[model samples]
Target: MGKPYRECPHCGAHLDAGERCDCGEPEQQEQTAAEERPRMRLIAVCREVDKDTGRIAVICL
Candidate 1:
């Protein structure tokens, strides 16, 4: 089965999974914050906020 998914930075409106936002985005854009994620916690989606600095959080699989 496919994995449960989250929204694309371009696609997700209310923060849900999708390939592209209805408003549209550039192809150069990468996957959503979730897809780029290495993994999610077993129970919950990790909450992270980055204002500046190096990669804030580079998810390592």
Candidate 2:
């Protein structure tokens, strides 16, 4: 017989009972937010430039 296991909701990793996944932890969340901040700021800047130039700015992500 095998022991039962469960899936981690944040990362879909298999975990034993009473175990927790770090994927949803604050540290990882903060890192993700930090990574996204620059991209968002770039988009905002591009929008402002486009408005001033009267042309669509294409951002390749």
Candidate 3:
């Protein structure tokens, strides 16, 4: 099943989980802020060799 949908109280627009309608109401602003918050992710870099030829490639994530 998909996430339940909610309606914006101010604009009566449909919203998904952690989503806000375009009305930008104060109540929705807080949710939007939390959703817009920056998050940290792990990136990996590695060296790989191709089977066809003897070469090294640097991969960046």
Best by TM-score: 2
**Candidate 2, position 14, lDDT:** 90
List, residue by residue over 1-61, the lDDT tens digit for candidate 1: 8556655565455534554455575444555755787884564443465767433444543
The lDDT of each candidate is 0.53, 0.71, 0.76
Error of 1 at 11 (Å): 13
TM-score, prediction 3:
0.32
> What TM-score, over all chains together, does every model reach?
0.18, 0.35, 0.32
Query: Which residue pairs in candidate 2 collide?
Result: none
Please write out the lDDT profile of model 2 over residues 1-61, one tens digit for every residue: 8759889876889998898887776797778878887553343334334567688666644
Clashing residue pairs in candidate 1 are: 6-17, 7-16, 7-17, 10-21, 11-20, 11-21
State the TM-score for model 1.
0.18
Model 1 is weakest, by summed lDDT over 10 consecutive residues, at: 52-61
lDDT of 2: 0.71
- Highest lDDT among the candidates is held by which one? 3
lDDT of 3 at 38: 92
